[model samples]
Target: MVDGALFAGPALRRLRRREGLSQSAMAARLAISPSYLNLIERNQRPVSARVIVQVADQFDFDPRLLREDETIGGVDGLARRLSDERFADLAIDRDELNEFLAAAPHAAAAFARLYDNAAPAALRDDPIIAVRREIERWRNHFADLDTAAEALADELRLSRGDTGAALTERLRERHQIAVRILPNDVLPDTLRRLDLHARQLQLNEMLDPASRTFQVAIQIAALEFRSAIANLAAAPQFADPSARGLFERHLTAYVAAALVMPYGRFLRACEGTGYDLAVLGRRFGVGFEQLAHRLTTLQRVGQRGLPFFMARIDRAGQVSKRYAGASGAAWLDGDASCPLWLAHRAFERTGELCVHPVLVDGAGGAPAHWLTMARTVNGRGGARFVVALGVEAHMAADIAAARGISLRAEDATRIGQGCARCHVPNCVQRSLPPHGAVLQFPALEQGVTPFRFGG
Candidate 1:
């Protein structure tokens, strides 16, 4: 059984809501204080083994059943949706996912079912399928695009103080378009939209200043660099028309990031600050994610930054989006990353950078040692996400992240590939035995390990 320390508050909340029982009623049935029960349900306190047994006995079912059936299915279903090809590169957290599950279980179940079976073979073969494939293939680096964007950045003379003004002036002078921030009701679901006939760029007033600035830069790029984007998208590598179109759109976002942080200046700051994202974000007036995204694109010919791999995962350990700085690195495309990774730990303490020197097994030909930095960020509608960035140990030493730490083998944390492929023996955190490895569970004795595998 999972320990109470890893208390699942969301599951407890769902269970209570499902049974139509008040907090007091449930506490009385479980023979616990209502205040303590409230804490457990709210995830402030983990439900102890005693409480679990009491709940099982009171509810007249196995305690394990409560956990197994609670919200695992919903989370798994949502993970599948997030991993879909269309959302391969987007950081999407459904705002209604939890609310819908609580208010209408049947509807939520139906939605999950529909989403699970939503994509057919034809849909998977969409024209833009290659765009996502190329991103993964290139490890998220676009040397040509980076060069082009750098040139544009230098031309625009972009800076934090004047990016908004520059883009606004360009929109009006070059495209004869106007920028307007509309109320939430006017542009409820979108951050920004362009109306060609009205010659106006509409932005939602709900967005923060940084986000609004990004939207404006993207619009300006779309208007000014249409030919450049189209030419890059029509490369021989792109097989489908939709792929070309999507690539074009991604190029605009890349352009926006490049404009915000010009390549030469950003690289200088990065080197000076030892790749500190917070410092870079503040200097560039961008968000953490934007800074990280820009970091991945810093492969400009002879002038390159550290080789970094970045990933965005939800609280439930689903990897929504991932990108590598160079070849030979492994990214957990669909499976849950190792639970022991500091990235997951950051969820407990959000907005703080937790550093770990990890030895990654089965990472292709990449260096075994890596210095990783993990932090959690809150998204729209109470959605929390963890972002992790890492560089090989050799490259990490010069960076400030490696300071105040011993880099010896003994000091490093030994992490395996995910459970399915991991071969580590006697690990308390092992979720599943390694595939094809026989397990010998002696009845007479049990070690701290749940299972022992035969060599």
Candidate 2:
């Protein structure tokens, strides 16, 4: 008997429609009242265990399909879209949103699509910023591409060892693309470049084994999973070609991560090893940042892992990448990241494990804190970057890194979401005052920070 909590009414309706059976006809076949079937199809009434059994026995249908919670992803996506600054005035609640999605998923998706077409492009002020946001959105999570990658991982029998060889073999046998490792001089700063006319893929020699394998996997995904990747790219409905190009590149990267780590296996390893990034990286033949980024994507339903927020920042304090896992926290919201974030400090002291406490919205309320561990990673052109992995303070007890770390409220370092939204009254690093807050520059009195914000 399918649980009422798991019943997907929209899915059942679609399945019924696919079988070309009207509500009355389906009800008659199932030996149930047409009104009851109609109510069940509309999600106004739950599907009983007898109804489930009848549907499966009579129609040879997979009952599990009707119980899947695929609408949750749509719900989350809708929530994120509505949280944008443009929709700040929205007064929607979570329960209502979920109900809407559960009952009318197609309508919800159409509404989201309309918002995508009409809502202002993310980071519209700067083209580069807009492109970055679009790319990051897909990088955070693309359900379809990730699913395809997972299926490919299962089909290809991908493992931690000899991934490059396997990918090369597939490229050669399936795509007829030759793989080559070019000298540093020949392929200056590039990681992997495909020569379609020559039927060759050129990768830089300086990259480590895992990196090479990842690049090769990316190449394979580009050629092999082109249609799947392109389909996801079109879903964003990107107006800029460059943004779409960036989406394609990141989609290949996503596929590459899946090829190297292969969702289920990597997620299991993460659980078995307490999510030790170093050990997991070694086991998967990947880098710290690679594993860190991949850790944020263990959002697969039923087979999920811990919720970890990962970010990459440069020495200049510019955030290049951000991903929030199932936590559903909008860690980055277009404001300059707080300078005190451990991701920035990791640059000053490389290779050191720093577990810092941060309050997302500062004091004077129910503070939301997170414990993050930051470490440095080498980037292209001898540049150094910082990668951080963290979870909520409440969930810190579950993480290995946060073990033995202080969880007292006072132990957390006071920090704000960002300069524009931060309410830190005396923050020395305050570059700008909080939006809508009155700025007071007392001519006689001075504080540690540049400007003082009035209450």
Candidate 3:
């Protein structure tokens, strides 16, 4: 079901057994008998839940991870070769493999590598799984920007939203520039740069005010910070041509945000305003979603925000965007469902702000703090995505005024339609996965909610 050799990687096994103590002094570290620990390490006894807890809690191991446990995963020699059939009967040097796995854990991605090689067609057909990795890779690279933004946010002592807007306003004032938006046809998928002196920003001028601000910000980014953005996007993982293109696009957007909200100066505003969305939007001439997107991009190590994470969900459970800060809080795999995702209540009362708090414990089983602010926003016709975040609790007060946006709120935050994607067992509106969660049930049931995913 999973990678075979993953359990047998000796380096991983050794890391598990170390327990933050020398092998000889292991007994003192755990306050347990070293002989018992030896037996456990030598495959004499299966690692129990209690032992797992001790290792994780005591030595800061991710306790919920099952890979270390033989019951869950163990890097045995046989498993390693089985997973890599090329090495089968090829006399693998166990010591060499251990050393390789020890220093370069990610290089030993046997599961996905083997699976991809085994069935090329499967990879092509399953865009959901194929794109999943790419999405996260993009998210990760974008997320790193959080450090710079966070430092700026903290220094400003203002809400991140406020920080972004303030920084944009500062840019406009400092540069004496005007912001404008155009249609998708007018603007390219990413930003462009022309002569600032000629008022020559060729763009999609028909877009909304927020979109306009974003375009200008992107232009400014390309002009002021192209090299920095390029450097960040160029890395080992992003070497592939297609992947690099996607990475650059994502970074271009980020550079736009960064320009609109220079981290150091913007961070001060964020702390000052407590991350008020509307005011911040007004400052930067961007939208609420844009401001929130910038908030999660603060990943500067020492100068950080309250460690906010962001996810955009539509009526259905498809996650359109997920950006996790340095918190290492992985998003749910395969579009994990959340009942609180629906924000129908916000639409009933226009201009009323509401907070529905929910916790997301991902596949790894860690509680992710998410205080999702689900207000309906206007889309092409009906409604669109409900935006929320996993932000720090301390900044809630600053954002209280911004959350009361109800005039544009959609039914259950489904955005654009009542049932476009309400596949909560029986959503009648779902024709497919809007946010891109695979539908598991088409034959077993019919539409129950406003959206359904079964064909």
Candidate 4:
């Protein structure tokens, strides 16, 4: 193969199959010989830019599809799935995995799916995990929900008047549901509840204006977009009733967020403000966490915002909410975030933005640099949680928060996903040795960390 040439055999073959075209037919459409097309399909010859453009123009498809890394079920995703201790005996290397993926991408994806289905009952039946996995699978962007919300927003003229008042009036006029705010003593345990008998939606008086608006929007979602949300939740993967219920609730919240912040308007504000979280929050009348969460869902096809990853962690370092967006790093898959991450430190300086650039140790691939911004937000009942947003370091120039910050690797803090999966040696804050490492303890000498392990 020529040096630095593009090889996209799997993608080309998939496109051909999708188009239901024979190799000769596709070659004829592209004005190329069948023999040369065959070589390209087999990855023996590099796909030229001219051919790429011709394929795009002929098929009316995005040219970026051909440039995507067709690493089969995602290199990191498959690698993490194989890292399970059950596959320890196989001892698969990176090269072998790559070869297998390249040889049979569909089979590789099937194997990953099978592995997921074969998980232990405890992990498989966890409704929360299932819901989170489903969210990540869709990259937290639901076009149907976004479109519905945008239409509703336009009908309600949400951009012109007070959003909450407009939504409340809509409920009264359209659904005959009166919005009522009751004292905490009246509804001690519920934030929002719908009474079908009286056609009333009750909210706790303690909820702030933003929270009240969000709860109202959620009611709208439950009433208006029930079929859409139900259809999304009906996927076979959510066989568990609990999982389905959780997913439906998540979708409801997603729609509510979209209603509150219409996609086109919000995305324009995001770009205009250089993605300033505080400014966006104020403009949209949302809290810090809501602003961060909405930022991850701006993945409309042609007008995509920066691919940002968002997470919410409590004081105990437990991640309650996480969206990987386009930066689907394996670290975002689990709750074991590194102690050194700014999310943990945001607790010390509540309500203050903490910005840091860090090098995240990839599981078995090249390291990734990120520009992470974290701040504490007050949740319901006075509970405080840290919400962190991060984007790839290369995108720092476009972010307002990353201004005046150096993105050099040497100047960044080195952190890992967590101690159990991280192989960064001698980390002073490591709580456990990394997987597959040989632990060593010498009585005569003391290391920075409690456990010394061989790579």
Q: Which candidate is the best by TM-score?
A: 4
Candidate 1 residue lDDT tens string, 1-455 = 12114354556667788789999998888888989988876656767778888767776656654443133244323433443434322434433444444445555556655763466866556654446545544445566656666676667667535777777777898888999999998887887889999999999998787888899989877876778777777763554666777777778898788777778899999999988777887888888777777777766656877768777888777777666645224434445788878888998886888889988654122226778888887666457898888877767777776788667656788887567656566778988876656789798999787868864
The window of 10 residues in a row where model 2 has the poorest summed lDDT is 67-76
Better of 2 and 4 by TM-score: 4
Per candidate, the number of residue pairs that clash is 2, 0, 63, 0
Q: In candidate 3, what are the lDDT values of residues 1-455, reduced to their tens digit? A: 12122222333246645545555575455566767666655544445546666666666866434342222112222232232323322334434444444434445555435544676675544544433344343433354454454454355444455543554564466566544444556564533345478555554544565665666556555555567667765652433456566656667777667655667655666677776666666765667677777777564434565556666666655666666543333433334345444444555544444565544322111233445565555544345765655553334434554354232222123222112222233534334544344445467765455344432
TM-score for each candidate, following the candidate numbering: 0.67, 0.75, 0.50, 0.84
lDDT of 2: 0.73
lDDT of 3 at 409: 23
What C-alpha lDDT does candidate 4 achieve relative to the native structure? 0.82
Query: Model 1, stretches more than 4 Å misplaced?
Result: 1-130, 236-246, 363-367
lDDT per model, in order?
0.69, 0.73, 0.49, 0.82
TM-score winner between 1 and 4, please give it. Answer: 4
Question: How would you order the candidates by TM-score, starting with the best?
Answer: 4, 2, 1, 3
lDDT of 1 at 325: 49
List the lowest-lDDT window of 10 residues for candidate 1.
68-77
- Top-down lDDT ranking: 4, 2, 1, 3
